[model samples]
Target chain A: MNLSLTLTINGEQREIVLDDPRVTLLDLLRERLHLTGAKKGCDRGQCGACTILVDGQRINSCLALAISYDGSAITTIEGLAENGALHPVQQAFIDHDGFQCGFCTPGQIMSAVGLIAEAQADGDAERIREAMSGNICRCGAYQGITEAVLDAQAKISTGKERDAA
Target chain B: MNRFEYVRPTSIAEAVAAAGEPGSAYLGAGTNLLDLMKGGVTQPSRLVDLTHLPDLGQIEQLPDGSTRIGALVKNAALAHDPAFAEAFPAVAEALLSGASAQLRNAATVGGNLMQRTRCAYFTDPASACNKRAPGSGCDAIGGENRAHAVLGWSDHCIAVHPSDFCVALTALGAIVEIEGPAGRREVAMTDFYLLPGDTPEKETVLDAGEMIVAVRLPAEAAAFAGNQRYLKGRERTSYAFALASAAAALKIENGLIVEARLALGGVATKPWRVQAAEAVLAGAAPGKEAFEKAAEVAFAEAKPSGDNAYKIALGKRVLARALMMAAAGTPERMPALPASPFAPLPEGVVNV
Candidate 1:
């Protein structure tokens, strides 16, 4: 039973024919589309290594079936750059050294982007830390991650302010 | 995960009809369902995807002042909704407290209500869990169960329902709207979850082919908006399930409690609501004395099912502390750590 679906992934429209209904969104991105930036640390939902954006909201892609997300716009780690320039969050992570092993960096950056867009972090360090609790960095890079999120949020908000002005 | 037929229903009637199949299951967000499926705990023949259905993704304020939250509404969306947060602060706090931001963004309200136990025995296919395989046996009773249920647990099963949102909803007297083969009906949140009696597999009051359409919070439940809190005690500061938790709401008039609602989580098979404890708090001054008495009444029938005797004592303290926080009044803004015990107490509020 082949189920056909279309996904706007990383600003590209990709048509997919899924032969298995059990294929998760993470597997589809990493295996079929070769979007290996989104790592699969834990196939279970407990780990946020497979976090991605579906219609601008952050979700654990490992637990989401590909067939269930038909026609939805998805954004992964590969989508975070513009014109080969790093996204603010990605730049901020590099500036603050937000990772060590880097296995969880892609998910961390994607989740940070989603968090900043949600605007619930309010540029507060504690709020950012709480919000990013889902994306675990086993290397204990949370201090840098939190700092990076705060910095990126400030940069984004200032950019918005500049745009409005 | 086992392969299954995926059915996307455009209408509630269609979804219900498709779910009427012998081995069909209603799939909402698939946060819990897919996880359980991958773990080999449950294998359904077909999944009726309910995310496509219209009108189940809205949060509506009815003319009668009650709020109707769609079953498909995401947890984060509902919690961040200013009107909902202002009206049902405790519920919002509870929602924010459970899981991480990513999970909250994908997990639906109905999925949260329908989530199974976090019991290791239940999730592991090798273990003999009565809740997972009915009449098989319960390994949790004699296993490592420091996190097991302490109230309303039977010999058949001792797994606690792991939802902080349900804790607050049980206290607010939320009503679950259901669509089933027989037609539409409503069940109070307090009665929606069933205790693990002899039929441990039957977790909720929902029958076969029934789907949760929406959950309604009556207008009266908003009365405690000013003085309500959901406090969770966990091993970690964040992103962990509760060791024990309590939701406390009070309506104070002339320095006396007119009505109080209290419920416990992580300590029972269901969100444990003790009306007798509320009766103890009624007309009493919102003080440490009254709160302590209420906590005692709340845990009157609680007994540890395993090595969880500490949960009963911890649960009582959580209830008392939550009552104190509620008496201190809801915060002007949500705490940085929404429901964590480490969140700074409101001014003039002392520790329990």
Candidate 2:
């Protein structure tokens, strides 16, 4: 059975047709829409390569079925940059070398962005670190990723910019 | 993943009715169920997405001074709740120490409780895992079982229950308030997850149609909480499966061990409670010797495999040290040494 889902992606309102109940939002974005910034490392939820934001909270899009999320506003790595400008979290990652091969960078940056926003709203470093723990880098670049989160917090605190493939 | 009918039920009755079907499943937080589906492990005929059901998404206080946590309450929210932190701090610590923050944010309490094994063999379709395919046989029994259970494992399975939150909750005397197709009933934390005896397929005793509505934990257990600690031993420092873990909750009255609760994870198929050990130290004065003896009692029934024999000793050492650290609470006490995941499993890889 097919389900029609209307939602926002990168600030644009779009409607998606879920051909199968098993097709996830991440699958819909990468396979159908061809927005492949979110990599599928494990397909399972163990890896955080498919992290995205729905209403400003980080969720593993692989586990979120497309039809279930029927009218909610969604955001992916493709949505982080607007009008040729990058989100502070993405920029901080670039500056801090948060990723190496960068396969997991988009998901990492997305998780960091959500975490930093929560931190700004009175979340402590421990809380931020605890929250961002799901996103893993096989390159063992956690030190850099955490530093970039702090850096992003600093830049977002002031006003600065940084993104690219 | 197999094609299934989907229904985003907005109310509990609708959701329950949808899940009441023969092969219907409740997708709470969709953490484990979806993962299993993609791997072709579980292919339910229908998925009743319960995220939209408002009835199962609340956290409130009961008249008995206990807290009722909705099944849909995200792990992150439950971990950070003021009442959870203050009342069931061990549970809070367990939740925090569980999957990283992002996972906890999206993972619901019910989902976390129902998460499947992280065993590589189980996830790998070709591998022989009895839990995944009953009567297929357990490869971990004689294979690479460094991460497998060291206690309460039968011949059929040795896989461990992966939640750190359940370990502490087991010790805190938490209860599961559930609603099945028939009616609503409550289960204590101890009886929730079953050990892998002859039937590895039977994980929980709950009826198939029964869905967990809320988890109610005694608010008083938080009062007994003092210097709670959750120590995990993993291959890597962060975001890896546990080799062995210890959860300690101790109370110091009159400079002695008035009450204590200890549970082990990653080393057992169930959240193992050492009540005998607790009974040993119930009135005994706090000291290294008493703690060591009590720790030994906890591991008394440890039947280890080839790769985890040292875990018997390692669990005792860490449990003793963690209990000591928890009891002392002052800076004068020295921290326990990190345990090693060094033991190797036996030679033959058994497949039923």
Candidate 3:
């Protein structure tokens, strides 16, 4: 059965027509919308390759039905950079060599963004590692990933402090 | 995943009616449901989406001092809720310790309670599982069953319920509010999950068409907030299911245990509450002697179903350490590893 869904993807309103109810948000983004930036690594939600922000919270898009997320705002890895400048998290991932195969980097970066927004870690390396435990790096880049998240969180907090001052 | 008819109902009545059908399933965040579907474990003909329903997402403080948590409240939201955490620290810690950050962000309180066993045999369609298919032989009995149930297991099934939150809820005496075609009703958290008897397929007390609306924590359940701990023993420090877990809560007065609440998880078909153990702790001082005695009573009826005899011993240690940690008092802040054994504990206390 065909279903209609309206998603504010990457800060842009895109009314999508779903030909099937079985289409996951990850499938809808990669297959139909051609937004393959959100990789589909273990489509069963075991790996966080398809992680994305839904209403400012990180979730496994592979397990989410596109029809269920209608009228919700979503953010993907593609939206991290603005006007030719990479988001701090994206830059930090590169600076810290957060991935070997770059397969789980998009998910790691998106999860990092969502984690930073939650602000529960407070830039603690242990807390960042714990909070980002959802995303797995098969290439064994957890150390770099943890360092990247810590650096990015420190930068974001320092920037906020400067703005407040 | 099979293509199913998706229907979004805005009201509880409508959702209940829609899910009453034989092949209908209620969709929460689909964190677990979709995984099962993708694995070809469960294929419902119709999905009744419950995400859009209003009034099922609020966390309210009732005038009677009880806290009514809506079933739709996301796990992350509930865990991060400062007031809720302060009132039910172990429950918050259990929720944080479960699954992963991404799953918790999307998973709901009700969905967590409804999650199925992580047993490989149950998920693999080729394997004969009595829990998955009634009357089918249980492959887990002779198969690799190191992580199977120890507390409650029949010849038919040995799968354990993989929920850390339910363990803490059972210990704290949480009440589950249900709405169904018949009417609204409440069931104690301890009684909500059914043990695997001859009919392992019947996992819960909920009849067809009944839905969990909210979970209520009695005002008195908050009394143990001063001394509560949920400790989980997992294969990994994070993002792993529990091998054995314990939720321990004590109400101590004048160096004596006024009351105690204890429950075991990842070692049973349900959140196994040991009221007998609690009775042993009453009027006794909180210390190694009493905790060890209670741990023995807690595992008095436990027996391994398969190659999981080690779980019985591991479970005993988990409960004892959890009680010791609870007696030491809850930490001011959530541990960095939440419920993991690696989290920093009281001085002179060893990891289980």
In order, the interface RMSDs are 0.7, 4.0, 0.6
What share of the reference contacts is kept in model 3?
0.95
Decide which is better by lDDT, 2 or 3.
3
TM-score of 2: 0.89
In candidate 3, what are the lDDT values of residues B115-174, reduced to their tens digit?
A: 999999999999999988999899999999999999888989999999999999999999
* Each candidate's fnat: 0.98, 0.69, 0.95
Candidate order by decreasing TM-score: 1, 3, 2
Docking class of 3: high
State residue B222's C-alpha deviation in candidate 1, in Å.
0.8
Question: Could you tell me every candidate's TM-score relative to the true structure?
Answer: 0.99, 0.89, 0.99
Clashes of 1: 0
Q: lDDT rank, highest first?
A: 3, 1, 2
Model 1 chain B: weakest 10-residue lDDT segment is: B343-352
DockQ (Cα-based) for each candidate? 0.93, 0.48, 0.93
